[model samples]
Structures are given as C-alpha cells and as structure tokens.
Target chain A: MEDLTAVAVHTDVSLWGLFWQAGFIVKLVMVGLLGASIWTWGIILDKSLGFGRAKRAFDRFEQVFWSGQSLEELYRNLGDKRTTGMGAIFIAAMREWKKSFEKGARSPIALQMRIDKAMDVALARESDYLAARLTSLATIGSAGPFIGLFGTVIGIMTSFMGIAGSKSTSLAVVAPGIAEALLATAIGLVAAIPAVIAYNKLSSDAGKLTARMEGFADEFSAILSRQIDEKLPRT
Target chain B: MRGSITSSAIIHAALLGWGLLSFSAPTPMDMANSESMPIDIVSDVSQLQKGDKKAEKNEKPAPKPTQKPQTIPDAQNVGDSETDVETKPATETKAKPVEAAEAPKPSETPVAKPDPQPEPKPEVKPEPKPTPVPATEVKPEPEPKQEVKPDPVAEAINDVKPVPAPAETPKAEPAPQAEKPAEEEFKLPEKVAMPQAKPTPPAQTAKTPDRKETPEKPKTQTASTPSKEKDGIADQVADLLNKQKASAGGAKRSTDQASLGASKTTGGSSLSQSEMDALRGIIEGNWNKPVGAEESPDMKIIVRFRLTQDGQIDGSPEVSGTGADAGLLNAVKSSALRAVMRSAPFNLPQDKYDTWSTVELTFYPGAT
Candidate 1:
C-alpha cells in the first residue's frame, strides 16, 4: 500500500503540475484506484505464501514419508494433528489398501486404483488452494487498464474543456491537465502488470506441483502393488 | 455851352447803355438793333424822302431837332442813376434820329420804347418821355407789344450762340438737366471706395484666422472626437468581438447584444474596438477550441464581479455553470476585474453609472 501510495504520488506529480494540484475529488479517485490495486496486491501476496507453503510442505512430506520409515511408525506419529499433507494422502491410500485385503477383494490393480483416487483428491484440493487469489488477480490484471483509461479519458476531457473555456492555445495550457488525466491509467497498469505476472507464475507452479503429486501417487501405487503381489498365493 | 456838351455826352452814353441793356433780355437786343437801324433809316430817308419831299423832311428834321431840346432836361436826371442811368441816353439818341429822318418813323419810336424800353429801354425812356412830341408816340403802344418777341429772339441769337445752349440750358432747365447731374453726383467715387477698403479686414480675417486657429481648433475638436470615438467603441469593437466569438468555436452556444450603455449611452464603451480586439487576441492565442465542448449545449458560465470605487477588484467572482474550471474561473474573474480596474473608471457610459457599476459577465461556452 505504501509503495502504491508512493507510486501514485510520484506518477501523479511527475506527470504534471495539474495532477499534483488535483482537488479532493481527483485525490479520492486516485486513492480509490490505489486502494484497489493495493488490496489486490495483498491478496496476491497472501495467495503466493499459502501456495508456496503448501508446495514446500508437500515436497518435504514426500521426501520424509518415502525415506523408508516403517508404515506403522509413520501412522503412529501422525498423532492428533491433521496430517493432511502429501504424507496424509499416503497413509489414507495404505489404509484403504489393507482394508481391501482384509475384505478379500484385494488385488494389485484395485489397490493402485484406491491410492490414485486418494492422491487425485489431495492434488485437487492443493490445486484449489494454490489457485485461491488468482481469480482476483486476473480481475485486477484485465480491469486495470480500463479503470486507468476511464480516469485518463475524464482528465483529458476536462483539460480540453478548460482550454476551450480559457480559449488558450499554449501547450502549457493543455499538457498539465492531460498528464493529470493519464495518471490513473498509468497507476492501473502499475498494479496490473505485477499481478498478471505473479498469477501466471503461480498457476504454472501449481500445475507442476499437482503433476508431481500424481507421479508420487503412481510410484506409491507401484510399490504397494509389488508388495501385495509378493504376499498373494501364486494365483 | 455846358448844356450842349452835356447833351451830346449823354447821347453817346445812352447809346452804349441801350446797346448793353438791349441784349440783357432777348426782346430788347432786337429793339436796340431796331433803334440803330431806324437811325440809319433816317439818314437814308433824309437823302430819299427829303430830296424827293422837302416839306416832310423839314417836318421830320424839325421834331428831331425839338426832341433834343426836350431830351436835354431828362438827360440831366438820367445821369443821376448808375446802371439804368446810362440807358436814358440811348433813348434820347434814338429820339433825335426819329425826328431827323421822317415823321412817321419818328412817331413809331415811342411805341417801341414802351414795350422794349419798359425792361431795357425804360432806363432810357424816362429821358425821352419827358418830351411832349414823343407823348403821341407812347399813345400807339400796340407796336411795342408786336415787337416784344422779336426783340428777345434777335437778342438771344446775337448775345448767346446756341453752342452754349446745350451746356447751360440743360444746367438751367429743371426737367432733366439738374436731375441727370444729381444722379451722377450721388454716385460719389469716395463712398464706393470706402466699402471696397472695408472688405479687406474680413478677407484678411478669413485667411489668417483659418490657418492660425487650425492648431487650436483641432486640440479642442480632437479631445471630444476621441471620446465620441470611444462611445462608438462598440461598433468598432464588433469585428473583434466576432473574432473572439469565432475563436470560442462551438464552446459558445450563442451570442447576445450587450449594449454598453442603455441610457444616455455613449457610442463607445469601456471595451473599445481596439481593446476588445486585444482581448479577443488574447483569448484566441490561449484557446485551442475545445472539441465536443458543444456536446452539451446547456453548459455555461456566468461570472459576476464587484469592483471597488477605484475600479480595483473588490471580491471573488461568483460562478455558476457545468464546465467552469475553478482555476480558469478564478483567473478570468480576476482578470476581468483587473482589466476593469486597469482601464480605471471603466470607460462605461457616464449616464449608465448604476448599471455597469458592478458587472456580471456571462460566458457560455455551450450556449447554443
């Protein structure tokens, strides 16, 4: 918000004296635009942190859970805390596989299918989390120029009218006003560009993490399937 | 002896006096000539009738000789008077000749003497009338009457030639003679020459005053001419106003005729043509002609100003309109007031002091 405020002040002033001297109304408009942009930026930061934490946690959980710890021990240590990380997905899949064996419906294919389903659900949930602030960011990205352009259009209209009313032809007469008018658009883009770039990067990163979770689920299924095949009667 | 010489001297003096008196009136000059001719007649008659009739001649010569005896006492009395005393002698001389020639001619002398001699010959008649022999000639007074006009006619012919007639007759005659010269005399050269000299002063004034007064008259005339031109400022301002209006483009919806002065207004206003042109120029120079400004035709700005007594701006402008820019509004309001103040005393119509005292300028960019 502060940076946005600074940008606003800098842009408004450096643009033209008129923008600098803009009235309370214009200041309100600028403040509103900046406020919106700052809000969107905050959402972006929050979503980025949340998504990064989830991806990092997923990776850490994958590494530790697959480090050859005993399955029963891993389950015992998952105590009370919602172990709804990638590690939790592995536990859920294993529990489902054992229940299916006890039900006499156990097969390598059925067990792998249960693990993939649980992993798919986990990946879908993580993907939803990762994509949280993106919609707002997309909105900010697409709508910013239009908002800025609205202010610019207003400012230009006002400047031209002033010229006509004053009957002035000097560039000095028109430039400041026009510059003030365009400031809103510039600020809009300032908010929008970063949002667009961050959103794209976060979305692509979320896709990669989802793909890794799927691959992990596939490998976990394969190991479980081999273990189940070794224990089965040579049928 | 003294009496005879006196008689002879009186006879010569009388002849000369009658000659002068005869010519005094026109009638008497012929009468005197007749007397002289009669004297010549007697001498001829003395030679003819006397030589032929000796008794008649003796009688004529006897009366002539006795005429002298009777004329002798009268001649003494004639010599006492001066101007006419000399005419008495001529009567005596004519009387003597009358008796010397023939009795008939001698008898006719007294008749001619009464008519002619009363005016001219009377100066000589007193001398001759005293004789008893001429008393009978005086009784035949009809002959004097018959000889009156001839005497004057003959004397007039002899004494004054007709050459002097035209000159003195026209002078003496009252008909046209005196009248002609009076008119000529009325046209006195001096009276005419006096007015001719009098015209010079006015002519001199006409030339000299026009030149000398030119500089002076223009000073007074120009002082008034400018104000009058100032009053006419609006008409002069019309063209510049149009330029200002056009520069406003569609910004101004409409224009109105703002009369500078309504009552007793001058032809010129505070905004002279030149000043308005200057203002228009300023506006044109500054304005870019707003595009789509006319989209809203109802938009307008009415700025009102209050000027101090000294023509300085007294208050902030009150503005009302959609398109009014606060800065522009402020500047224009202030500038208008400053212009009014700078123009000091606002060259407004003096008579409309109340109306223009605090002006409200209505500028509508989108009037129409």
Candidate 2:
C-alpha cells in the first residue's frame, strides 16, 4: 500500500516542492538554470532601462543641439557635468574643436580629422556599454536544455536502479523518479525560453541604440567640420 | 544592476509561487482517446477456451480403421466384401463430421442392439465389433455380447438377419470361412480390451465410430477415412484370419504383415499466452535468418514436432508444409528446423507439459 503512491506529498509536484525533492545533482542543475534565468532577466531589465535612458538623453540633447546654439557654449555647459552615452560623444568632439583654436589652428583638415577621431572613440565606448552581458543570455539559452537533459537521464537511471533494487515493476517505483528527473528538464526549458527571447529583444534594442548614436556622431562631426571651415578664414 | 537583480528575483519568486499554487489534482484519462488494450494473464488455455474437442478426436481416430478393412477382404468369407464394405463406411461416414457423425452416433448405439438380434452368437459379436469398423464398435460389441448370451445356436444356425451373415458368411464363401472365425477371436479380444481399458464411453466411441459398420454402411465412406485405428484393427482382424490359414495366402500375407499402429492418445488443457510467447521468443532468438533467401516474398514453411517434459525436442522437426522457390525454400526451412533444434531445453511450466508437448510453427521468411 505504501509503495502504491510514488510521491508521498502532492506538494512534491509544485515548483518549490520539486526543488526540494530532487536529487543533489538534479537540484544543483535546477538551481544553476534558475540562476541563469534570473541573471538573464536582470540583464534584460538593466539593458531596457539603459536603452530608454540613452534614447531620452539623445532626444533632449538633439533638440538643444539643433536649435542653432553656439557649439562652444554647449561644450562649456557640458564640461561641468559628468556626461555619457551620446552626450559624451558631442562633448569629446567639441573639446577637440576648442583645443585646435586655443593652440592656434594648424590645418582645417587636421582639426576635422582630430574631432572625428575623438567622436569615434566616444562612440566605441558607448556601443561597448550598451552590448555588455548579452553573451551570457545566449549561453544560458543554449546550454540550459542540455543541462536539464542530463538531470533527466540521471533521474531515470536512478529510478530504474530503485526498481531493480526493489524487485518490482510497480508504478510507484517508476513514476516518482521519472517525474523528479523530468522536472529538471522542465525548469531548463523555462530558463531557456526566456533567455532566448530576452537575448533577441535586448540585443536588437542595443543594436538600434548603437546605430542611432553612430548617426549622431556622423552629424556632429559634419557640424564641427563646418564650424572649423568658418573659423579657418578668420584665423 | 543591484535594483534589477532584486526585481528579477522577486519576479522569479512570484512566478514560482504561482506555479506552486496552480498544482491541481491529476485528472483521469478519457478512455475513448487513450484506447489502451487490456490483456489477461492466464496460466492455462482451458480456462479461456470453450469447446468440446471430441468431434475433432472422433474425426482423427475415424481414419484409423477404414483403411485397414481393405487388407482383410477375405476375412468375412460370406459376401466378405459386402460385410467389409458395410461396416467400414458406417464408421467412416460417422467420422464425416457434424450431421453425418452425429446422426450415426445415436443410430450406432441403437443399431448395436439389432446386430446382436441377427447373429445371436459369439461369432456374430466378433464380426460385429470388427465390421462396425467405423460406427460399428458399439453395435458390434452389444450385438456380439447380447447375441452370444441370448441366442448363440438359434441365431447362428437359423437367423437369416444381416448380422447372421457372419455365421453364414463362412459357409457361403469358398476359401477364407475357417480363417475368419479364428481372426474374429484375435481381433475381438484386442479391440474389446482397448475399449474396456479406457472407459465404457471411449470403448463405445472407439469401437462404434471405428467399426465403420454400425448395422449397415456405404462402401465409399469407408474408403476415404483412414488412419492408425484402421491399421491396428485391420492388423488384429487380418492377423487372426491370416494365421488360421497357416500364412500361405497372398491377400492374407498383406494383412498378416500389417503392423500395429503406433498412435498415442493424449489430452490436457491449453497453455497460456505467456508460455507461448516465451516459446516463440526462444525459437526466434536461436533463429539466425539464413542469408540470401530472406527476401523470398512468398516463402512459407510449416514445421510440426513434439516436445518432452524436460523441454528437449522429442524428435526431429518435420516440415509439414512448404511453399516458395525450391532453392530458397530449402534454405529457410532448414534454418527454421535448426532454430527449433538449437533452442532445446526450454524452461516451461512442468504442470502444463501436455499442452506444450506438441507444437506447430509457421514461418514466413520475409523482411520481418
């Protein structure tokens, strides 16, 4: 009669109950996959906020930059603040402009080249920040299923071994071990599906943000080059 | 990053809690969709099977006597052929199955009373027993016993009934009248013993259905049904008559030379499916398919053999039937027989030995 029921408690089928019921190795696998899932979601959240913040900052700065204000005043106003993302690129390029005039302009072409180079470096740093920690999402998405499968294989093997030891083919001997093993796989899938979806979503967002910043740099460099052209004749 | 981690942890914990709360009782599967086949575990076939095999047994033994009568054509002496023809067909027709066998069974029981009324002598009893070679065993026995008891002299000398033909049969014929009387003595005693040994019903059955002539029979029916019973009865009757004549006659020699049938009667309950499956698995395991001939699409091979109690092959398996290319057929047939031989000493239930003792297997060599 005791053997008839495989799992003693109905709670064992629940997520927490299953976690506690799992074998040590299977428990470890489940924990690892869960951690990966949580980490994946965390990265998703941070990236989401970061992309929004960059977009809003770009929107504000673009409004002001396009209003035909003096680039020197804008650069001086940004100098006092610790700026980043798209704003940092504009500041880095403007400082290069100010430096050329203060040092007495050598060549307009050289000034144009230095300002472009400064903006390019700032853009590289911004893109790097946006793309951070995404590779872990891809890793979790791909490896999670395999890890779950390993747990399942081990669980079933253990179940069969129990059956052999008990000398019976009763459902009680079979079902619980198999159920416990399959829970690993279930958790793995749960972890994997989100990681995969979030990785796709967040990476695409990052790509779009980087592309927008690259366009800004290109436009800002052109403006700086034009300002240098105007100053060159006066110098 | 720290805030995001806390938020992600809270979300995962909430999801996990929801999953835990959502666990419901497992519902029973809808049988219409599941469609699982149910099988019963059984130890014996008799428990599951329903039918009387007596009919089959009757047909099987029926052939034994009919073919024997042909050898002792001279044994009756008086219209010897007519008497032989009449008795053999009665049992043979009774062995005909269903309407013919059933109709004659009841008729033969009653008919036994009449055969005795005619001969009313010891000679009559002997002749009746032998003549009912098919259905006549009972008729012959009752008649002979009844006749010999009630009206031996009057029935032998004065009765002109069809059965009285036995006493008169010797007188009317020229060569074998003296021989038949002696033959009846030997055949009757042995035939009587065989029936008596089993049970009254089996005796009545063995003799009545076997005698061929209960009271009277058509010659044609006797000609068709032939088996070991015919050989044994034929030998018994033939040996009696042939010996009395000092063994010089040609037709007598053939009857004299006839051997006693080596047939055995055995019965038990059928084996359960598991036993059959085990037996099949053992055979299939040993069967390494003979190469090059497995592709013969139409090949069919049937092998029949008996097994001993210890699970050893009792005798070499006989290929009872085969249909395929002659060249490929032989390869598969031999391979099947080899498998049967190699898979000896099968571990089977000792109590159910009778059921598994005899087996017939059909092999269709193909992609399977």
**All candidates: TM-score:** 0.34, 0.46
Cα lDDT of model 1 by residue, A1-235, tens digit: 7744654555333433344555455556666667656666566566566667777888777777778987667766774457654666677676776677788764566666776787677667756765666787788888877787877887777778889999988987887777677777777787688778877887787777667777777777777778778876665
DockQ of every candidate: 0.00, 0.37
Interface quality of candidate 1 as DockQ: 0.00
Candidate 1 accuracy as lDDT:
0.50
Model 2: residue B312 alpha-carbon error in angstroms: 27
**Chain A TM-score compared with the true chain A, each model in order:** 0.75, 0.90
What local lDDT score does residue B144 receive in model 1, on the 0 to 100 scale? 35
Q: Which model scores highest in lDDT?
A: 2
Candidate 1 chain B weakest lDDT stretch, 10 residues: B37-46
Candidate 1 ranges beyond 4 A from true positions: A1-29, A98-108, A231-235, B1-368
Candidate 2 lDDT score at position B198:
32
